[model samples]
Target: MAPAAITLAAEAPKLSAANTGFMLICSALVMLMTPGLAFFYGGMVRVKSTLNMLMMSFISLGIVTILWVLYGFSLAFGTDKGSLIGWDGDFVGLSGIGLTQLWDGYTIPVYVFAVFQLMFAIITPALISGALADRVKFTAWALFITLWATIVYFPVAHWVWGTGGWAFDLGVIDFAGGTAVHINAGAAALGVILVIGKRAGFKKDPMRPHSLPWTMLGAGLLWFGWFGFNAGSWLGNNDGVGALMFVNTQVATAAAMLAWLVYEKLRHGAFTSLGAASGAVAGLVAITPSGGAISPLGAIAVGAIAGVLCAMAVGLKYKFGYDDSLDVVGVHLVGGIAGSLLIGFFATGGGQSDAAGLFYGGGLSQFWKQCAGVGGVLAYSLVVSAILAFLIDKTMGMRVSEDDEVAGIDQVEHAETAYDFSGAGGGTAARAPQPAPSATTAPNTKKVDA
Candidate 1:
């Protein structure tokens, strides 16, 4: 083992109050991302399916949190077993893990690291909900996330982030989670959507977003929360690299938003709010892995490319005959791949890692390594996610009945409606009128003067 790795393993765990506090705050920020995602997805779905969309994202918070504490963390971050996955039940339920012991090289306590990672685990599976929106059974969706997190996310996270994990050892530069979170979730979205099939009126019906304002709000929240997602991956380094990551995140997102707007105006003849929000998200995704390694200029380039490409990519569902309800395949999957692969050309070697990119005179070695990492995660996630979706579909049922789907999932599944139009003579509202206006008392009192 290298000296740094040896030191990481051998050092006694100690606390850094600064790092601990920073990580705690970062965890909270990351936690907000799930709800942010909920709004982002919720707003894009039809009014009838809005709550269900929100629920899908929210449920992951509950399921993954419990699972992570129980064994998800252990499977992802536990002692390495053959570089495939982590092992050891000791970390399950956080058992036998000392409170004072810091993670290998970090100054924060192990518990803090676990919780920080827990936030990532929660959101990754939730990212898939958008593609499967409007048609899935809520119970089945919950079960799918639980199983998917266990089988797919846990092991993949281990591969990308865990010590002695294959990609980690192979030098893949995923600063935050381009491969582990975005690409992984995006690929899984494609797989599940393939199995579940398209929405009922996917092409013929005009399934425009019920509320773009809501989506804009959600996108704003996501942009605010992503700072923690990307910069906090530094884990309280409080150094120049973290600052650089922060700046790059902001710059890349703005550039992507602009790029998306430009593309939209050119292609569709209008600058839509949806385009702006989606473009911002694309920038955020593109910069996630490369932000810490690349310069601000590189960040802009990455964001612009992702913005244009993803905007173009979203239309692929129509061409390819797939119904990616919210374009998860386009924005996340494509954006993630762009970010991870671009690191090969833009990396400055000045950040946390000393690996330089081809443009920086490092050659194509890093680029090929990046391709390997992206391809491996994409392939694994797609295959496993498809099998999981298929098994769930075969055994219990994945999609709701056609009746339930068209009648609105909120009413059919949750027995509640997102918008109540009863007062205005709309949608299932009671038509009870005022009790005849107190017939004897008030009718003529004010008319006496007339």
Candidate 2:
């Protein structure tokens, strides 16, 4: 009887309450970034759409959070039947993942891990909306996010991060989400931008930011929360590797900020606040892919390159006549590719850790692999995103009417105002507003010929 009982005993894993607590906090930290994005994007747009811009990020909190708990997690991280996607496990609807269960070889409660990742899933799609701002109907945007997550993000995440995922099997290392988050969103942003067409009077319009101060504040908040983002990828405290990644994040961000300011001073004769914030974000995106794999020096290089390339890429839309409103493609897509490829050259140690590049005598093998990986991801993302956008447009329509767009999405869609310049203490416009001596606002005109 004793022998039989021993045979029947389940293998219970030891649990760590402290790790669970740390991870739960990390999840909350990542959640804060969406609002950080709200302010970041809000300050970049015209004053009329300030609330609407922020609401795009706010809406993700409601939509993706609920979907992630229901099935997004299962589809994203569950056991994969092949290299492409995962099967529905009992985790769907979070069934049987109780307060006491283990997850992904961690000692923390599974629920904590699930919620932590869910926040990442929620904010990723919201990041892309900046590329297609000021024109999409609110309802159309909501539906597009839902379908995009279900079809595009989930499968790509499974391919990169899930058990038996193709990239994981191929030794493609992403500490937090260089490929899944940045490159995927970047390419998808391009797809939607092409399908949706340019914003009204893009090149002709001066289209200056209504509030640069708000954008700076948002950048500060995002930088603060990123400690959780990169470190939390380790999913615990007291982790030396996580500590290294944390340090790398700060180092890269500072370097990129300095690099961007220097570039601005060189080109424009003055350092702009917009350049500082954008540079910080570029550095953050570059460090994200290579954070766990490279050294501090590698991080600095990645950040510097990302800063320079992204600053240059922002001007491409003007040259090529595509309106990438907020430089999502410039910063995220270009930065993501730069980091992923640079790691192939800079990686140290041997076996899984040693991904040497052309300079390191590993020859062009690793570089080619990196190129293939980047190309594959970009091609797949662009094609699938276009298809998804087309479907959504065909079924539910994609853009708001020209009249609704002119009126501001806040008034038409959410029925709210971001500011009250009226004297009556309400949101009404001032009846007898006099024009300022100088026009701080850039004129809304078509700047480039299409």
TM-score of each: 0.92, 0.90
RMSD of each: 7.8, 4.6
lDDT of 2 at 236: 68
- Tens digits of per-residue lDDT, candidate 1, 329-444, equal 99999999999999999998888788999999999888998999999999999999999999999999999988889889999889998787766554444555556666575576
Following a full C-alpha superposition, what root-mean-square deviation does model 2 have from the true structure? Answer: 4.6
Worst ten in a row by lDDT for model 2: 441-450
The alpha-carbon deviation from the true structure for residue 245 of candidate 2, after best TM-score superposition, in angstroms, is: 0.3
lDDT of 2 by residue, 102-182 (tens): 885777888888888888888889889889888888888898889888988888888777888787777677878888889
Q: Score candidate 1 by lDDT.
A: 0.92
**lDDT of all predictions, in order shown?**
0.92, 0.83
